[model samples]
Target: MARMPLAERRRQLTEAAIRAMTRDGVSRTTTRSIAAEAGVSLSVFHYCFDSKQALLESVLTMITDHYIAVVKEAIRPRATLRETVRAGFQAYWDHVAARPAEHMLTYDLTQYALREPGFEHLARRQYELYCETYAQLLEQLGRQTGFELLVPVPVLARYLAAMTDGVTLNFLVLGDADAAAGILDMVTDHVAGLIRER
Candidate 1:
């Protein structure tokens, strides 16, 4: 219908794939359906992606990118490290509250990747991305705020990633926003305690 760059087309297809997977499921969603969701021909989907693994990778990355962008924006230097950290965590929680389907799709995609033959690496890649995102965010915050962390960045990053993953999953399972917020506050305080003014 309209001329678009390959990168843009791939992004479009990736978003469409997310919707298709969230609605139908990773195992049930077909490339043909993704093409239909994106209003593109199957050939266009093929042109953008070589295989299901590639599409799955794109979908996972897109989902992570979505919240990372929000958290990065929310994490900009604040009056205090606790405030900044809380803002970032709150931003992510808001996204989960608003788009539970998308968040749930991420968990589903991970399980699908892990269980499917020849796609276990996608699940690993998903967790790696999570850890990497936390590490990058920690580095960026440190640079911006000039705070020293008692915990090493790598260790802290993994811990934060695992903690947030569990919290999100807990909220998803319980559907309790209040409990999620309280847990987030506790974790935020714990994390803020890990940092000291340089």
Candidate 2:
């Protein structure tokens, strides 16, 4: 039998790890199990990742990075602050809705991150990157629309980021799409009103 290509194998392992974490939760995911699911050997899993924590961190980073890029791309040039906020939320809703399993993986890792040193740093980095990305977009929109932010850009960015994370958890836990949508609309309107008032 031919050996699998290295890049292909790595991708398979990452995806399999995400699925495994989603099904069994990060605490239950092991290198052996991930390798078995990927149809690879334990050595192959080790070759790709130093440990299960690393594998889970990679999965979380993959999900967060992909969504960050999507949200960044969705913000139109010359966008009003309100329009940019709407676009960011829309991107988030679509991404979360489409990849519910990835979101579950994120939640599991988040729970583990509270105690796991390996994942704690990765989680913090991911959160900081996301905040900075959103803050940059917000600042740009503020400049374009001549609407000063009521809160500091960093504070506003963190607030919006936390709100989205909370909404994702609420939607996943309660399966309440209507409530989630309504709350997001309300939050966006309030933020818009604040921006206009400033």
- How far is each candidate from the true structure, as Cα RMSD in Å? 0.9, 3.1
**TM, every model:** 0.97, 0.81
lDDT of 1 by residue, 35-118 (tens): 999999999999999999999999988899989999999999888889999999999999999999999999999899889999
Predicted candidate 2 versus true structure: per-residue lDDT over 1-198, tens digit per residue: 258887777778988888887888878888889988898889988887777666766776677778878877776643466667687688879898998878877777777887776567767866786687778778766665667877788888898888888999999999898998898888978788768634
Model 1 residue runs over 4 Å out of place are none
lDDT of predicted model 1: 0.94
Task: Give the whole-model CA lDDT for all candidates, comma-separated.
Answer: 0.94, 0.78
The best candidate in terms of lDDT? 1
